[model samples]
Target: MNIPNRKTGFFLVITGASFWGVGGTVAQKLFQEYAIDVNWLVTTRLLIAGLLLLTIQFFKKDRSQVLGVWKNWKVAMQLVIFGIFGMLAVQYTYMASINHGNAAVATLLQYLAPAMLIVYLLLRKQTMLTRLDVVTVSLALLGCFFLLTNGSLSQLSVPAPAIVWGILSAVALAFYTLYALPLLKQYDSLVIVGWAMVIGGFALSFIHQPWQVDITNLTVEASLYILFVIVFGTMIAFWFYIESLQSLSPKETSLLGSLEPLAAVLTTVFWLREPFGTIQWIGTACIIGMILILALNKSSSSKTSKSNKKPLRVS
Candidate 1:
């Protein structure tokens, strides 16, 4: 890759991840201040971003793939499964976590997906645990302990519901990362992700209609925040990150992706003034340390993971 392009890739990845982190905090503001429903926000974000992405793909080389993905019956079924379970589940659980707690905690909790994926691989005998993996897992557990409990085992710092939803979000993210590979290998990421979002949004509409949700408290500023979450957060963020992969290695992107949680934490604390305890900050460092270890050791990762070209698409 050209050096200039690599530099651009680093900038794009960081900007995209930062958008995601800030978007989460923005959503938290809407939820806390305006009492926006998580379901409605998820539904709206998916539909709009999905349509926008597909619109972009329509003018690109992968235009054919957009329609081609649904030509096969088995592929269609797989797409539906991925849309509802992978995309929808990940989005809903994450937003629910934010609604129940603050964005910093929720985002950090979701970062545990990589560790969860590693453990899943080990259980399947697809990958063996190394000393590094051991340290990674230990760090993840310890980090989560302090994050949720603030170094106190007897009491929880974050709400019970937030912790539950955040863990579920990680599970959903792991599933998304694992199952999305085959589709992404065959089709462009835009086509796969775009269609998945549309399918997920459509599926969710029957249960939670965005149009019916009360917007009486919606302000001009709130509308802009919502727009930012849908456009900058979902579409531009994913597009930029995917584009950056053309110039950067998966390992490099994974390492830099740490900025997402960092951005979320900083934005939540500084902008929203969410109170974070000292012990909780230590937990955040440990979690980030785990990500660094994982990325640095990517070369020694199992063949199964090496075949997987991308890292977890954390939001």
Candidate 2:
């Protein structure tokens, strides 16, 4: 098979990231209108997304490859983790954040995953903390504090539980990124994602008890919104993300992928007319700045290390 066009893949990555960002806004609308429980929304999203992608896999690729991976016990166990902790945890925590807080705030808090990853890496001794890392983390945390406080620290009126949920969501997202890296090395991207979604969906389904909900009574708009979550937000976006992983290094992919939260914030502001206070905007900018600094610092350090390793000609 021919390699995908890099430019095309990059474009798809950005598009997918943007869709992910905007997903909260879309979900928020459904939540308000249909009164859909967050758990049911998440379960339905994963099931529908999993089935749809499975169909695509059957048509576009060899089914045996996917089935073969599923049959592997070790890989299946990994998929279980991917589903439960990675997909399910991230989705549930994020939805909980949205339920407890507004979409914009929840979305911004979730973007703290990058900073969390840096901390996690440092803790694991996988990476060392440089001055730049410290400053970047500090900036990201300050931005988060601003968002939490809505810029007026004096008010400090944010709910404690909501803040905890937001932090949990960030942790889940960071773990998802870390866990996915190793799995991608060992499995076909789509197959790994498909099985993970299936497992995660079923797990969440049992937890959510979707059968208890009145599925037939859902209005057309609500039903369509759920379908949109399954189709555009989950299946298509995840497929593009996995495809991008095939082409880009993890750091490059993640750095470019920070566009998701920006997209979400913009979508909320423009489409929902969600109020964005000046303080909120400043916080958002700081968050983006921190991410940029981390990405650039990583890139520069990588380049310097490579240059230092070059062979010296004594002639």
Candidate 3:
């Protein structure tokens, strides 16, 4: 067995999460400044990113897994479901949340996926509750309340549509995380994620043809932002994050992923000048605290989760 290197894993996951964090900020800029629709961006990003990842995998890694995946009908079916309903749904919803709101709020809300997954496992009897779980749940709930309501019982700090979409993003992400497990076990994550993304993009293209967008008015800055989101945020970020599982524990990787929201919050507040008051700060701390606790709890649970055996474990 290849012993996992924590040093490299930490760097990979951190860089991946950082890119994702900044990517959300760029996405917000595209939505707010460029008026790019969430549908088109998600469609194009998924298609391009998936193709890029598959191309890289084909050239550098296992070439057989790329094409061999289609041979199994059951796997293909599952991949389709995972692609359309899981990965695509998460991508679209997260971007939609950013469209409706700012990156800070959208990113924070998506972090709720871990808690949602825990609740799901509880319902499915796959996992039992521990004291740590209870504390984590409490922190998450309290964090969400503060972040959304801003300590006010009557008024919502953020817009209603954003909140709804943000929650939906979390739900979508939870499903994505769970549904990808079987496929990941069968093939490399690059192959499974790459193909799922292609499938999802194709399925969504019928409804919103990303090609229909007018690029004539596209500003140079907007173009750069779009490129960053597709290349760094979606492709490299996902690739490095997934690759880190080769060396890091799922818990450690997830703990490092807390950087995503932190990055989003900082960039949105400082660079974008989106409002984040004291209450919102408290909420951010609570949620990040929850992430930290989750990582700490699982310190000894698994030393190194095999890449083929584990899906991307993000919080």
Candidate 4:
């Protein structure tokens, strides 16, 4: 198999992020029309995503990789945790945030994943802190603060439960990026995502009990929207995310993924007619700037380290 070029992988990452951003608006619309519960939405989305990926794997590749993953019980257990903590938790928490608060607020809070990733990596002793890292973290936090407060700190008050869920979602997003790094080395990206989604869907189904809901009343638009959530949002986005991790470090991928909220804000404003105040724009700019600084810092450090590996020419 031919390895993908870095540029190709980067393009895939951006495209995946764009789809996720657009997915937010679509979900919001569906929520407004269907009033669907978050739990049901998550369950349906993951189940469909799992089934779709399984179908793809069936036609293109053999079942050997899938069976191999199942044979390793420890790895399989880790994937279950990955599904629960990384996939289902994030989705459920974000939806809970939206239910308790507004879409803008929920999304802004979720964007804290980048800073959370830095803290997690530092705690795990996987990476060291740099001055630029400090600056970037500060900027991202400040950006979220501004966005959440809508430029006024006095008015920045969310429900306690909503805040808890939002923070959890951020943590889950960070965990997903971190866990995906090691898993990508062992299993095919699609295979890993398929199993994770299956596990997550089953878990969410038990909690949601979609069978109790009135499936007969589901409209065509609602069904289509749910399909989009599964196919484009969960499956394809994750595939590209894992692929990008193959070439980029966890921090780099998280930083690049910061574009997701920006894209979400744009899609919301343009398509859904969601209001985007000037303060939101400023906050978005700050977040983008912070991500740029982090990426540049990583790039420069890589170049410097490579240059330092010179052999002495003492003849």
Candidate 5:
């Protein structure tokens, strides 16, 4: 097992998010420039990445969790639903959004998941709305408005279909986050995520038929992109992010995850030469600020609660 180190944890999380951002940009390139089918790419990505992750979990990590997660039929059913509706939906919609729009836009739009999750919690009566919640939701909405409209009422920078898919992606992600909590608490993160992706890949294969995609033009460069998408983006990205949780609180990890959209935006603009407007930049800042506020608030509260405990266990 790896020893817990704050610096390593932070670095791993940053690297993971950076890989995801660059991978999304690469997927966008394949979609736009190569005429690759979205369904096939996503289906293959989920299956291959899931297998790679599970192989690692079974060999290098805990082998018990590989089988323990599927012992209960009730939980199994829930996992299936979570995999199909949550994981598959999020993946497909996100890629679809990128297909219709650009990586920077799609990634920033998916960052709306935090706001969507807040609302879902409210609806479930899981938590009451605080002042911070109000601010967070407002900032998300305002940021989205600026991003999509550039503060203009007349036109949208991205297509309407892309916006719809992007919003759907956020909704699916929110579901995936909340629904996977119970499983995550019981099983290893790697096990849960890997199996979920496997289930999702299997279900999506009916429509995508991964074998049907044309790979005649699969050059070395394209092969490298595919490898990165599956290896670095799907497998390593998730592994590093989850591993970081052992050393850092979820709030801190999420705060760092705010780097994802930033990375995507930078890569999209510079690497891919995608255009980003000034108002969109302002919108990005607002969303990132919201993430920071939440992280800071959670950290302060945690410190206060710990201090109030009176060091009862001290020798």
Candidate 6:
């Protein structure tokens, strides 16, 4: 690996993940201050960001893929499923989580998807559950316990609705990761994800029209933040992370991606003045530690089997 290239990859992935983290916080701010509707935001975000991504693919990648994804019936069905259940579900549940809770908790809860995926694979008999896998799942569950309950089993520190939405977000994320694998393997991620988002956006727009939302009373700062969430947070963040893969291993990229939840936690606590308990912080460490352990294990495994590439795990 080229040293400078690796440095650039690290920078790109961190910046991309940080943007996603801050974007979640920004979305939370909008929900709190302006009472923005989560459905409308999700719709607008998917439409605008999805189009922007496809436009990029058109200019820089194979233009045929921009429309070619719809050519096959089976692939089209997969894309549609991925759009509704995978893309749309993940986005909606995550936004709902932030609406009911702080960005910090929402992001961390979504990270539980990895453990969930492990269990899913184990159940399917696609992969055997090793001791390390058991440890990973245990740590994830324990971390979530402390993060939500502040180490108390009786009550949740966060709102009940927030817990519900956060777990749904994790499930959606796991589905997003697994369901998109076949499509991702066959086509460029940009193509698959772009079209999936477009499909999701169109489906959502029918139920919650974005134009119906009144933005006339919004301040310039609020407008800018909204723009940042769509443009920087969604489009650029995804783009930069994908680009980073050119120079870094998936394992390395996933390891550094831990910064996403960290950034969300820090920004939520300091920037938004959200209260974070010490136990919650400890829980955060535990969750992040699990990510590190998983990534390191993948790195070790990759040495023996170079063909076993992990799928793209965008937030």
Best by the lDDT measure: 1
How far residue 96's Cα lies from its native spot in candidate 6, in Å, is 0.3
Candidate 4 similarity to native, TM-score: 0.81
Q: Residue 274 deviation, candidate 5, in Å?
A: 1.3
lDDT of 2: 0.71
lDDT assessment of candidate 3: 0.84
Q: 38 in model 1: Cα distance from truth in Å?
A: 0.9
lDDT of 6 by residue, 100-192 (tens): 998999999999988888888778776776888888899998899999999787888999888899999999998888777778767888888
Worst lDDT run of 10 residues, candidate 4, spans: 306-315
* Cα distance off (Å), candidate 1, residue 211: 1.6
* Model 1: CA > 4 A from native: 300-304, 308-314
Candidate lDDT scores, in order, read 0.88, 0.71, 0.84, 0.68, 0.78, 0.86
The 10-residue segment of model 1 with minimum total lDDT is: 299-308
How are the candidates ranked when ordered by TM-score, highest leading? 1, 6, 3, 5, 2, 4
What are the per-residue Cα lDDT tens digits for candidate 3 across 106-218? 99899888788777777777677777668887898999999998899999999988999999999998888777877887888889888888988898999999889887799
How far residue 45's Cα lies from its native spot in candidate 2, in Å, is: 0.4
**lDDT, model 3, position 41:** 89
Pairs that collide in candidate 2 are none
lDDT-wise, the better of 1 and 4 is 1
RMSD of each: 1.4, 7.0, 2.8, 7.5, 5.9, 2.3
Estimate, for each residue in 1-315, the C-alpha lDDT of model 5 and write its tens digit: 255488888998888878888888888988888777889889988898888878889997889889877899988888899889988988899999999998888887887877887777678776777888888889989889988998788999889989999998888887777677666667776777788889999999997798887787788888888888888877888888877776776766766867777888898889888887899899888877776776567632222223211110000
- In candidate 6, which residue ranges exceed 4 Å CA deviation? 299-310
**What is the TM-score of each predicted model, taking all chains together?**
0.96, 0.85, 0.93, 0.81, 0.91, 0.95
List model 2 lDDT by residue over 1-315, tens digit each.
135666766877787777777777788777766788888887878777777777777777767766777677887787788889987887788877777666677777877876777777777787777787787788888898777677775775356665787789888877776677656665556666677777787998776787778888888888887776778777888677656755665555656767877877887788878677777788888888886676555442322223211111000
Can you rank all candidates by lDDT, best first?
1, 6, 3, 5, 2, 4
Query: In TM-score terms, which candidate is top?
Result: 1
Error of 6 at 168 (Å): 0.7
Clash count, candidate 6: 0
